[model samples]
Target chain A: MQVFASLLAGLVFGLGLIVSGMANPAKVLGFLDLAGAWDPSLAFVMGGAIAVGAIAFFIARNRLVSLLGTPMQLPTSRAIDRRLVGGSLLFGIGWGIAGFCPGPGLVALGMGEVKALVFVVAMLAGMGLWVLFEARAGVSK
Target chain B: MTIAWSTFTPWSALAGGVLIGIAAGMFVLFNGRIAGISGILGGLLKPAKGDAAWRIAFIGGLLIAPLVYALMATLPMPQIDAGYGALILAGLLVGIGTSYGSGCTSGHGVCGLSRLSPRSLVATAMFMAAGFVTVFVIRHLINA
Candidate 1:
């Protein structure tokens, strides 16, 4: 039942990505191009998502377990360190260069975009490298 | 600077965002999991016992959604202006960064900010600033 819910959620999320124009690299690039022709549409997308998400999170905060009886597994980290900032900066640069974040990148690949396929493959490789580094550093995810 | 009013579709964007929000909300409420794509995909890389089913289901849903949309209307063709080299480099950076940072746009930007997480706020701001600077450099300075 939980797995079914997740599948349904992913389906809705992917549909949202397509409808919001997030699956299009050009549209994402337009939003990021503040110095050029900026499209504020994506801002509305974020706003709407946050508005609903805020309410849901509020409800989740008061609950000990999920509707399906699983423990609520929200992140508890609060420290703002170098890793967070540096990793975000690098991610942002990559986003600007490719105009493809993980969600949309995966969706694009599913749609048979060749470049997106390349991006997903490369991204997997990068993630593999992180696994190696984590092992060496004795860190667990 | 200037808003691309001609190309902007505020209503659809908002509606779509609502869908995303509801999806995320449902995921957490029912499954007790954050609907973060990168984290979900990363989990697949090193699958644990009894953890692979939902992740595979979620990804399968994402993959199938487009085909369903195609039955109703046309799917937008993604326009990628970057060359293959740049795309590969960008993908690598994003993968590594998200893993280290522990989130991406949907995770940090949407879910984290919604929960009023200080870490998410800082991460979002850093990534946004970095994105702006990178775009500025590439579009104006480097012309790449």
Candidate 2:
């Protein structure tokens, strides 16, 4: 049941990505290009998403367990440290450069975009590197 | 700063965003998970016991949705202006960065902000600022 719900949610999310024009790198780049031909459409997308999400989160906060009876695994970290800022900066730079975040990147790859494949492969490699470093550092998660 | 009003589709964007929000909302409500693509995909790298099924199912849904959309209308072909080298580098940075930051646009920008998380707020601001600066440098200064 949990798996089915997740699948349904993913389907809806992917449809939203496509319908919102976020799956297009050009559209994403247009949004980020504030100094050039700025597209404010993405802002609306964010606004709409947050509006609904806020309400849902409020409801979730009142609940002890999820609908499927699983314990909520919401993030509890509150510290704003160097890792957060630095990692975000790096991610932002990458986003600005390629105009492809993880969701849209995967959506593109699912559509059989060759460049998307390359990006996904490279991304996996990068993630692998993180795991390697984490092991060496003995970071117990 | 020229606003591209001609190309903007506010209505569809908002509608689509609502759909995304619903999906995310349902995801957390039902599955007890954040609808973050990077976190979802990243977990598969080192899968825990009994954890791989839903992740794969979710990703399969993502992969299949576009194909379903193609049946009704022509799907938009992604137009990436960056070269392969830039794309690869960008992908690597995003992967490493998201892992370190513990979230991405979906996780931090949408879900975290919705929950009024202070750390997420800071992370969101930093990423947005960084994105703006990176674009500025690339488009104007570096001329790349």
Candidate 3:
């Protein structure tokens, strides 16, 4: 049952990415291009995503337990520290340069674009680097 | 009104994002795990005792989702304009960033922030700002 829901959710996300034109790197690039032929369609996409999320969270808040089983786990950290800032900076720079974030990066791979493949490869490498560094420093994820 | 509604409608990206958020929330409820791509993928890379199953299942689900969608509807292929080198570089950067931050946008921004975590708020802001700056540099400065 949980697996089914997860599958359903993933499908909906993939479809949403497809239908909303988010799978297209050019469209995303257009949204990013504030000064040159700027297109705000991505904003609409982001806005729509937030609306659905708000309602969903509201409903989940009222539920005692999740559809799967346990109560929802929320992050307890309050420190606005370096890891947060540095990560965001890296993520944003990548998005700006490649026009593909993690979610869309996977979806882009489905499109069989060679560039997405490259991005995925590098993304995985970066993950590997982190693991190696963390292992050396005795930190766990 | 038209602009706002169109932007806010479920038919737009907001609806999809909301669904993603809800799914992440529900997954945590049932599985006690955050629906973060980086964490999920990372776990798969270095599996621990009794941790392999869920990670594989999660990634498998990701792959299977599109295949199922293709069977149901015509999946439009996305066009990527960046060169091979640029794409690879971007991916590597994101991977490192996810590790350094301990989460991705979905884990931090959507899931974490929704839970009102200050850490997520800052992370989300950084993600947006980084994206903003990256786009500016690429489109204006590098012209790539």
Listed for each candidate, the true contacts retained, as a fraction, are: 0.80, 0.81, 0.50
> Poorest 10 consecutive residues of model 1 chain A by lDDT?
A132-141
- Where does model 3 sit among the CAPRI classes? acceptable
Candidate 1 recovers a fraction of native contacts equal to: 0.80
- In candidate 3, which residue ranges exceed 4 Å CA deviation? A1-4, A58-65, A70-72, B1-11
DockQ of each: 0.83, 0.84, 0.45
Kindly indicate the candidate among 1 and 3 with the higher lDDT.
Answer: 1
List model 3 lDDT by residue over A1-141, tens digit each: 655555555555556666666767776776676666666776656555545555555656666667677555545567778877887789778877878877677777766667777888899899899889888889765
Per-residue CA lDDT of candidate 3, range B40-132, in tens?
A: 777667878866666666655655555666887887677788888888888988898987887876677666655556787788778877887
TM-score of chain A of each: 0.97, 0.97, 0.90
Q: Write the per-residue lDDT of candidate 1 for residues B14-114, one digit (tens) a residue.
A: 99899889888988899887888888998888879999999998988888878878988988777888789989999999999998888899999989988
Stretches off by above 4 angstroms in model 2 are: none
TM-score of 3: 0.85
On residues B1-144, what C-alpha lDDT tens digit does candidate 2 reach at each position? 799999899999999899889988998999888888888988998889999999998888787778988998888777878889999999999899998888889999989988899988898898888888888899889995
Task: State each model's CA lDDT, in order.
Answer: 0.89, 0.88, 0.69
Clashes of 3: 13
lDDT of 2 at B52: 94
Error of 2 at B110 (Å): 0.8
